[model samples]
Target: MSDHGGSGEPTPRILVFSTNNISDPGIDLAGSRHLHYPATVSVLAMPCSSGIKPSWILHALQAGQDGVFIASDGEECAYLPDCAERTAHLVTVTQGLMAEQGLEPQRLKMAAVCSVCAEPFAKYMREFAAALSTLGPRPVTAG
Candidate 1:
């Protein structure tokens, strides 16, 4: 209902952790094709989606990002047999901590993306941004 961005910024900013092997390329493809998503989106590449630490997500939220999106490698990840499973578990644990700390668990999201999934990647970003907007902003401090 209120302004979408947590700090009342006009556009909500999202920090995406994309795995290098799969999701990163998908994101790059989205850009090359000029697929329009939110301009406020920022991406960081990771060796693997399952490698993210809970503190990283907390730090991003504390550092003023409106939301954190995990662009998981899906079944294509070379790092782990169950690529999505590990990240999903991390998200679940992190979300519980967030709720305990009075932060909106909805501020964090995750999705599977393969190397050639540019169109789907764009769609996911659009949807995630809208969801973050609805959740408004996240609290600065973590419990």
Candidate 2:
């Protein structure tokens, strides 16, 4: 689903790639309260963080998304130990590539939160949104 709010101007788009059970309550509350900046954020759930292929991130950036946020279960992953670690690595590598291409690596982030850490997740989302606002839209490039 898409959560959008802001002035009429095109808001920075954020793709939230989730690798664990995202707390619906948290999402609802955050969406209802509205973030500090205009944002068009979409949530895409995956079975695990490792399941998120690098190509998906590249596609989002190439498609003009201003930023991407990846959330995983952290060390509490049910399927394996430290599955989020791989996701962290992927984010680092991807961010490096984006930087080399003249993009702001800070636009991409990886957060690890447990199912019960709803407050933290919400906080992270807000901070991320604020950061995106400062960075503004990414420059469009030929794909």
Candidate 3:
């Protein structure tokens, strides 16, 4: 399914999955701080970044999300000793899945976003939106 708004205007959408322990606060702070980002961006909070499953990312992509951004807990992760590695591994695997489906791996991005990183979170959101704009809509799929 393709979406271009009713007027055919490109309103790139993103599916953001954030770890609740660390990254969730940053998302909240962004709002409290009045950090502005695309209203089209949607967020889902997760208990731990390590608990993230690559299949779900694929499901969002297949469902026509312009891209997927994973907000890692970084050093603040409570469940895993090294959240970065696990997140990287998840990204790598998810990218491979995207590639296998003929999708660009660039559509998936991950970064360490702490609780106080409202600015960084907002910045990255804009960046992701821009990147997705350049990538355009998800590749036309076969029926």
| RMSD (Å) of each candidate, 1 decimal | 3.5, 3.7, 2.5
Misplaced by over 4 Å in model 2 are 1-4, 7-10, 20-39
Model 3, CA-based lDDT: 0.87
lDDT at position 49, candidate 2: 76
Query: What is the lDDT of every predicted structure here?
Result: 0.85, 0.70, 0.87
> Candidate 2: deviation at residue 143, Å?
5.8
Looking at candidate 3, what is the lDDT of residue 98?
A: 87
Model 1 poorest ten-residue lDDT run:
1-10
Winner on lDDT (2 vs 3): 3
Per-residue lDDT of 37 in model 1: 83
The reply for model 1, stretches above 4 Å from the true place, is 1-9, 141-143
Give a tens-digit lDDT track for model 2, residues 1-143: 12355444445678888754543334444556653323466777777777777778878888767788887767767776868778788888887778777788888888776655556767777678778778776765645
* Best candidate according to TM-score: 3
| TM-score-better candidate, 1 vs 3 | 3
What is the Cα-based lDDT of residue 20 in candidate 1?
Answer: 85
Error of 3 at 59 (Å): 0.3
